[model samples]
Target: MPVIAVLVLDGVPGHQLTAPGLAFGTAARHHPPVAYDVRICTAPGFEATGGLASFRVETPWGLDGLADLDDTDTVLLPGHERFRDPPPPDVVAALRAAAARGCRIGAVGTGTFTLAATGLLDGRRAATSRRNTAELARLHPRIDVDPEGSVVADGPFHSAAGVLGGIDLCLDLITLDHGMAVAIETERQLFLQLHDPTTPATTCAAYTPPGSSLAPTTTWMEANLRHPLTLDDIAAHAGLGARHLTRRFHAETGLTPLQYLLRARIQRAQWLLERTEDPVERIAALTGLGTPANLRRHFQRQTGTTPTTYRTAFRTFVTNLTPRE
Candidate 1:
């Protein structure tokens, strides 16, 4: 089993600590076992303060538990109320040691500040809550802050933009560990939905007319990304005319029906490429791209890289995290 160490600190928000356990633990409950051994560790005398008024938390493991970096595959840092303050030296040291030992590091919300403090994020792309993006950029100009991305990954470091973005990041890690199928199953079991990070927000008052929502149709499309879908087919599914579907889809999702379908297919292809050892041709067939050449052309157009190159980089990162037996 892969070991995931969640490094806790004083003032850590309650949800941030619990989100990882819920995500990874739920995956472990799935058939065939996407197993992870997750533990919470903190410095001696450390206590976590919840964002709510009535809660405080204590973990069983201390800083000593983190000393053996070889036993850890990933370290997740959760944001605290005082994220602007420098992290404890002992905590910073352990994080650096874990990175040096080839463990992937992830930060949630203002926790990006904690990871940023270690200097490991220098020259790397990262994301944090939109409210704190300016401060993060000002404090660490060497680190590239992606204000628009919900999740940003640079080499071994990953950062998420908001409180809920942590759940997305964890699900993404689960996808990396097992496969898209496993992650999808886990999402269903957890009653969670995974949103495409690149999709523009549809909730803006200007875009969403009162009482009008494309959610039902979009949800259907997400569940059926493997099919070769056409505009008419989508229109019928949504109980609208083709022209009406195009207008509503563009207005709601900021993408035309075909554009949305293309992005959905590419997203599916990316998931398969990152998590499965399937060949490009097989992935193409699975994602409804028809053939390897078609998948390559579309993938390069969207991502500016070949599917093979993306797979190699993702697999290399995964391999480096797995300790030799």
Candidate 2:
């Protein structure tokens, strides 16, 4: 069994910490028994800091209570908002010690900042959220950071971009150490769709913060994925002109209207494939991807697997074991 230590820093992004906890924690609940032993470790005397919401939280054990590097096989770091500021020397030292002891170090989103601060990322290829790319490069010139891809592993150091990408990275890690089938099953159990690194910015850029002006439009796109929507139609729904809609969509969500629509359709296709035993053509029609050939082409381009292969390999292994009745 691999004991995994998740280092949650002060002022960490609440969602970042919770993302891995949900993915890996759910994975640890597998029926055949999971190989991971995960724990959340905070810095000594660490009081919960304000994150996404106005709330305070406290964990049971602090840093001292964390399993030593000698005992653990993997150490995970979730992102913190304070990436420019240096971590405490003791915190950096502990991580370095873990890395030196050959424990795999994993960082999600801006947590790579902490790793870079410790010099662990020197000469290493890693990844961080696309929005943080320029600053990350400026702060740590030695590390090779890929803003496009989801996960990158340099030696034993693994990293991922975005909150969702962390799930993909963890699954990839488990798959590499375990097996493909186990990873696929984990994804099934978690209801996680494997992110397509090849899709460029459609899904990633389509994401918008809540309360943003474009959120309503994004929601509308999501709801209408199965419908053939033109840019004029989308603009009309949002009560805006095509040009204004395009600009606003780009500014708020970092994606154009068409890209967002395609991603929504692709995401829907993925869900239908995973959850239903419907034929590929039916899934395609439901997701607005049209014919089975079109569905297979797009699905394969995004997921590196054909629709039939993905459904056969993933849908069968998931529990909850209900046939389409």
The candidate that wins on TM-score is: 1
TM-score for each predicted model, relative to the true structure: 0.59, 0.59
Give lDDT tens digits, candidate 1, residues 27-62.
Answer: 777533357888988754456565556365666677
Query: In terms of TM-score, how similar is model 2 to the real structure?
Result: 0.59
What is the number of residue pairs that collide in model 2?
0
Q: Give the per-residue Cα lDDT of candidate 1 at 43.
A: 54
Cα lDDT for residue 302, candidate 1: 79
Alpha carbon lDDT at 129, candidate 1: 83
Please give the lDDT score for candidate 1.
0.74
lDDT of 2 by residue, 205-305 (tens): 13454457876777777777777889999999899999999998887656788877876677677667767778887888887888889887877776567
Determine which window of 10 residues in candidate 1 has minimal summed lDDT: 200-209
TM-score of candidate 1 to 2 decimals: 0.59
Q: What is the lDDT of residue 47 in candidate 1?
A: 64
